[model samples]
Target: MASDDEDECGYFYDDEDADEDGVAAFEDDAAPPPERRADYTGFRGGGIGAGIAADRLCGLRIFVCTPNPSSFQIRKGGRCYAGSAAITQESLYTAQKQDLSTVMNLLNIKQHQARALLIHHRWKIDGICDCFDRKGRERMLRDAGIVLQENNSLASGGSRIPVGSAKCNVCFEELPLNSVSTMDCGHCFCNDCWTEHFNTSVKSGKKQIQCMEVKCPAICDEGTVRCLLFGKYPEMAKRFDRFLLESYLEDNDSVKWCPSAPHCGRAIRVGAGERYCEVECPCGFSFCFNCAAQAHSPCPCIIWDKWNAKNTDSENIKWILNNTKSCPKCFKPIEKDGGCNLVRCKCGQYLCYLCGGPTGQEHTWSSIAGHSCNRFKEETAGKSLDTKRQQLQRYTHYCDRFKIHGGSYKVEMEKMGPAVAQRVRLLESDLNLPFAMRDGDWLTRAHRRLLVSRQVLSRSYAFAFYMFGGELRTRPADQATLGVAKNLFEDQQERLEHHVEHLSKVLNAGAPAVHQVENLSKVPVAHVPAMPEAEVVRMKQETVTLAKTVETLCGEMYKCIQDELLPLLVEPMSIAAYRPDGPDKAKELAA
Candidate 1:
């Protein structure tokens, strides 16, 4: 593991002037000075905004740029991060360049050829190496749609034409050498045909265009295509360039476009096998990289999808159908607010609520006279309805708690976040305060723990909903074994919930109350009253201790899910492991 300033590229900065180019590296572990800390300008412009504060307040380690003091950069570390990074449109080229140069240098291939190989391997350099070693270089290159050397002799010797002209196989016309193009696959076609083919392929959303000849798998040379098409179709050529640029994300397994709306124009790249992890973008959007949904860890992506679908309009309809019966005559949904088995619809139609059968508007508590539907039916239909009711009740039990914690998270993020930040500024500004007390990272870490725990606590309910409620078809055959597992899971969930709420309470206690915040809003930073020294110590100790406890409990809960619960299932399912700092803020890649 590298230190925060070591810059995950396997380099250490012994001093500030490590780079030969004179670009100073950030080496400090502590945050920037109070005057230099980024202003929270609510996620609108490019400067460090609410999104960065959300990350900082939540426990993420952010390094304020020295050159551009106002800029904030998220350092990747902590549990389950796996070295993920953010690649903006401007930096995508840089990110791709690193990999391209690696493959190019290793194999001594051209840039375009290396790119094709990387795209075919989904940008896994290790996978490419493995294939190269096992299958030999030629086979590996051939598999990746590259035919660099083997057929070059064939193209020159087998296709020698009358010095100045060659017949294109596609158009079957003799064209001068300049007017025709020869592909690496030893196939020659008129330049016009190649351009049309390239245009059609680009329009069809194909990033890699192959040779025009049937049964030929060689990828057409990108430079040649660009040279031929740029003169006649500049717009299409640009679109072609974009397609190739965007392919680094679309074709690669380790990267994905950020799911932020209005197009953040950014893509996230993660270490291989880390696709299941949740990540937060610099744009202030946090999502499960695997599913592109709200960060719902501890719940598998499939379970989250199912839970979301279950909460849609269809569930409301199911609730209506369960509680209400359609009127016999009017066919309108009717609910029996209270009374005997007999009920009257607003349409003046009478029916027995139990069996939903029409009857004269009269009935006793035990029986309906005209409808002999008092007897309980033990048929499959009745069993099905009973099962549905049980399922709905079970869902409601988990969903209510999930929603409650989710709501609390939003409130705390919006209200407590700013309040804590303000307190941090106030404490830092007070010069008379003890140097130890001035560092407010403890409070920020504690509040971040609260936010992350709240999220985990909320999503844990969703996991339980699908796991124990039998929403998933896969379950252990032994009912007693499952029962024991459920108990163990719920025990962990209960403990996590308890400490999360406790942490939240402590954070709220440390932060100024709503009215106090309102009053502090109107006061100057220096004028704000400093928290008592004893109180500050107590709060710091309590918050830091509670944060560690919550972090441990969260890790244990995830262990219960991954190790204890998931293995019992016949079908495979996985959730991202817990990160105490919340999702690691993906570091923005630099060119």
Candidate 2:
């Protein structure tokens, strides 16, 4: 913490913050006119002009700005600063000197409100619209009073007195004596319980992790969650530490283009990842970061003894480059643009350029008279599309948002998570809904997984569509699409059918009749654990044989689409139809 006098200026801020509150909104569609800017100019040490009430500001980050290089000087407490970017104030005063971007975040207010507070206060805030502008003053007043305060209802706490020992809210197990720790929910579950809660939350595989509280809108604090969960379960502890790695990548929307063709010639670059896990390049070129393709020409290791040695010696470099074929008589270089390896000398002698053998026209080697170009071309065809070619080029680029796979789970989640989460909450919260499923955390997670399952199934169908009846682009008619979709569903049926056989074998694997029990709690433990076997079998069946997995659901969905939706589209599509398997046809559908 800086002293009050120092905070009147500037300070170094850390990157742990997501900067969600009042940071500048990310601009995707527009870039505002630069010349329309207003001036923001001032960074100084000043006495606290007015006090801001805690409740007045929800998020605010303040920065004093100055355009001047070295003109103004302030020495109320005998301190010298180089520039506003360098300014530092001590204590609460230090925060007082933060950048406007920071100020907005700290206060959690819109620009208008921040301006309003500055005007109403009539403080020496440089960024404020000056001369007591009424609009600005009102905004400042609202912003200053907008404190971030919330009352979360999901209580978590240990048993205090009469209700026996504290139990784990998560696994429903008993908490260890004297070691119970409470979460922000104030519901005290044991360390193990909360650790599992966090692990399941992260592994439940959500883009934005939230508390277990139903309909509660609090974004759990990292510091609090970390303090509450560490040391109980080491696996969760390790993962929580790893989750912070996102901080190093400060911003999203970062991307690098493929270096190819019109630009730097098909080169690839990435800040990290090596290659795709599943797909391969069409060019038969594969590479990771450290080493992609082999070097074409070896470097000269020996040093020159004199100045004449400094000359480039293009002929030597050409030799290094392996320009094997040359005019035998003229001694000039010859490059074959398209054809094979046999060459005719300028002096009319014929020879095989690749093997330096004799050509058929009276030009002969020691034992053989002629060599054919056809065999040479055949031998080198694979190298034309080889992993490396000295003449052809390639390039690559790095961007955080640019994904290796055209299909990306990371990208899909950002678009889908919020909608899914909201839908789940709505399902759980609504009282009128007749769904029999439990309206609780685990159920919500299971629903989320179902969404992912459905999406993958759809993608697999698309892949099958491309593979079986040619591309969808060629045959997009309802009939053709359904024809391809049938195979996809069949493929899934085969997989799940296999699983059904596997689980059935488990039943007959000498476990006996004890495995068929319905309620394990109702049955004596000495008798056997019956319900777990059934539950496990049920889970597997639901994922596949029970007809809930993506493959089966996709088949049903495609059937519905064909039977219901296709009929509606068919007439209009016929009216607007163009030639099949053409770009114009694609345009009409898109339009």
Candidate 1, TM-score vs. the true structure?
Answer: 0.69
lDDT of 2 by residue, 508-553 (tens): 2312232232243465434442234345345434433322343344
**Candidate 2, position 101, lDDT:** 32
RMSD over all Cα atoms, model 1: 16.7
lDDT of 1 by residue, 507-549 (tens): 7777766556767757777565678888888988888998999
Best-fitting candidate, scored by TM-score: 1
Worst 10 residues of 1 by lDDT: 16-25
* lDDT value, candidate 2, whole model: 0.31
Q: What's the lDDT for residue 208 in model 1? A: 80
